[model samples]
Target: MTTYVINLDLPGAVQSRHLYGHFAEHLGRCIYGGFWVGEDSDIPNERGIRSDVVEALRALNIPNLRWPGGCFADEYHWKDGIGPREQRPRMVNTHWGNVEENNHFGTHEFMDLVELLGTDAYVNGNVGSGTVREMSEWVEYLTRDGDSPMVRLRKENGREQPWKVPYWGIGNEAWGCGGNMTAQAYADLARQYATFLRDHGDNKLYRIAAGANVDDFGWTEALMKSVGCVGCNSSGVASPYQAISLHYYTMSAEWENKGKATVFTDDEYYATMANAWHINTLLKRHTTIMDHYDPCKTIGLVLDEWGTWWQVEEGTNPGFLYQQNTMRDALVASVHFDIFGKYADRLFMANIAQTVNVLQAMILTDPDTGALVLTPTYHVFEMNTAHHDAHVLDVVAKDAPVSRKIGDKKLPALSASASTKDNSALISLSNLDLDHARTITLDLRGREVTGVTARILTAPDVRDHNTPDAPDAVAPREWTEISRVDGGLQVELPAHSYVTVSLDLA
Candidate 1:
């Protein structure tokens, strides 16, 4: 039996709603068919944007949406996406599938999508192949008010009022796809670009510099030296960039061959879980380095791109990055969120890569029939939504199951986290054991007796997933095994399951 001693009175950092954010790039069906299907399409839509996808994502309480590109952001020219759709120039998406982009879903369309979803915007700027004037004008075009060249252009295009853009990324991945520049070189460029990304009117931009690839401490250190504030007086001004980003993806195997999405053996499954656990180390090390530069923890850490990366489905466009999401993916998400809750103080925001129909997507859309199916990973987010903007509760596990060895690393059989808001509290648990069910004791402290309700997401097999015909094949259902105990509560967590218990506090 595993015992989780949760300290309800000792509340830590507030879990920022942006921490549960999502990402969508111009890749595969994520944009063209998944979110936008043209205003005239037969599918129910609101001015070219898919209504079903928006409604489904709205249920998750999506706080923010990052647009334009991952790699495509660096090469994207904002001008091509503006003005009339018929007159907008067509460009080949060199980073994606070599498919020609008609520029129909440009800046205005993305802003409209953000408005409809009632979420904030995190737009990535072009730096690798774009000029300084272009980025400056784009910011001016979207945020500035009163008389200005960019403002006039924005009005000429269509919109008369300026849109609010709170968060802006200086560039995507500068060390690799964005540009093959060295750490120092990219840091210099980041500083220059951040200078021109001005705050117009009442809108102040939270500039995020392109940070390190996984475990690239040198890159992080260099970025800190350039943008981080160290040993400064209290009178000193804040850093030009408010946060630095880090990108890490969980994979079952090597980058060259990242195994399959849904077809894998037990060894591969353990390997994937082991990989997911590695993010803790990455966060700790990066936070330590950031602490050295900015001891106050004023600047934030943004994990802007992260999720499972598996090989593309056979017979599909390899560059499209379309893969299946299974129970394994759901477990991976649960573990990530558990860790994110632990580091909420420094970790301000995180966006899972490609929210729909691409790479660990929440929803998959069929091209032929226009059918939409929610993936198992989607249920994990929906189950854990209560953690958003809630205060983190310290949970210590005792007498937990012994870790299993996978290759050189040990994969823990359990993952958990808890948070509280108003008079209610939420506890999320994931049992990674593939065979036997584990009984868990919740030793609640610093609070009186309360009512508890729980729901669980699980399937008979770890490979179980949802198809358009069977969307609820692996969905959440009411969990009734939970009961009040001596000091708190006790529940049985099945093998490879994700559970969330909601408490009505006294």
Candidate 2:
């Protein structure tokens, strides 16, 4: 096979902090059992939130977390989830499953979870089911420090002071579940709702308007221009919405016929990857529209919710939306990190659908068994965390082919890139072809490498996955040097694999 190489000499711009953000919704087992399981559970936890899960997230160096809902955000009422847990009303989760939401993991629990993760909180407000007063009061309840009813209520409920929450989503998927309003109508509603969200002294809440879904640049353009009109006036202060949110889910199967999580034909796997690669286009097209309106990159594009959506496992509740993470999922995660790293400038914040037990969740929970297992995607994130906040070095590899029934798609068996932090260089590479392993040669170009360590996440087969009994089926393995050529290093990458090469520069 032809070897692909990344010349670290020609590196792109450094990465932005937004690339490290994550999303956590109330869907499936993501919030309740995965992250917050009530203090009564036998599992290791802190105030209902899982301690191990929090530690795992903390280890990923998670930057920010968007919360409340996906479709749930639309119908979510902030009041029902605050104050005391017992007094907090129980509502049906009309979005995810018809399961009852007992208000156990409310605003306090969420903000507290973010605190434990050592990340900033991005709360998605209810523009669909809530009013201006309700949304604004939520801000006061969590952010206001002065003497006020909201603050007093907050203290009486337990939290004496306020938590500084900066990013606030005015709505979520407003074009759909948020209200199903036209761009013009949603823009007007956003104006009214945003007007009431007070900054509350020290906390500068970036009121992010619920933005476009996928290629709907019209929504972004209209909202940005209309909101820019509102923001430009009144002393020409910066816009109330510091960002605009967008959501996209890449699915290989149709809505009803979503493909299997692990058992997939080679054709299905390639098509799935093709769908994931479309993210590059989504970012480019959305950013182009935003650039036309705000050239200086004033407003950010928040892919608040994104990940692979597959059919629910057999015998599992359809509303649960849980699927096993396979090696293919790991490859998808790695490629996503590469795409987001490239677009770090325009992409402000994002969360990978969810953190656990939901669609493409990093952690899965079995409440019955009291078992918690990290998914393959979780290991991919952990491995690639080195790319966080590091410079994006330009990587170029000649296209390699992965043949499928449709046609010969450019597989690029060897995909590689470099990121530098301090004096260390982290090189991430992937071998895309499932059946063919490739020997990749890296031209270090004269950069002295004092030592090298390799970590790989792969499986004996592309379809290999982890169950509760086989959680470590596809985990990262420590590797030694394959070979050091005269001026470069040659590494053998397995078929359908993800690898991270760490170099300690002298």
Best by lDDT: 1
The residue-by-residue lDDT of candidate 2 on 1-506, one tens digit each, is 44445555555666766666777888878887788878888888998888988888887788888888778988888878887788889999888879899887888888888888888888888888888899899999999997999999999889998998998888888888778889999888887888889989889888888889888989988888885543334566676577888888867766677798877898888877777777888899888888777776777888888788888988888998888888888888788777887777778777788788888888888868868888888888788777877877766554554343433334334456678777788888888788888777776753678788898889989888777899899889996645787666788888898989898876
Per-residue lDDT for 46 in model 2?
A: 91
The digit string of per-residue lDDT tens for model 1 on 304-397 reads: 9999999999989998999999999999999999999988989999999879989999999999999999999999989988999999998897
Model 2, CA-based lDDT: 0.80
C-alpha lDDT values of all predictions: 0.92, 0.80
Each candidate: RMSD: 1.1, 2.6
In model 2, what is the error at residue 34, expressed in angstroms? Answer: 1.6
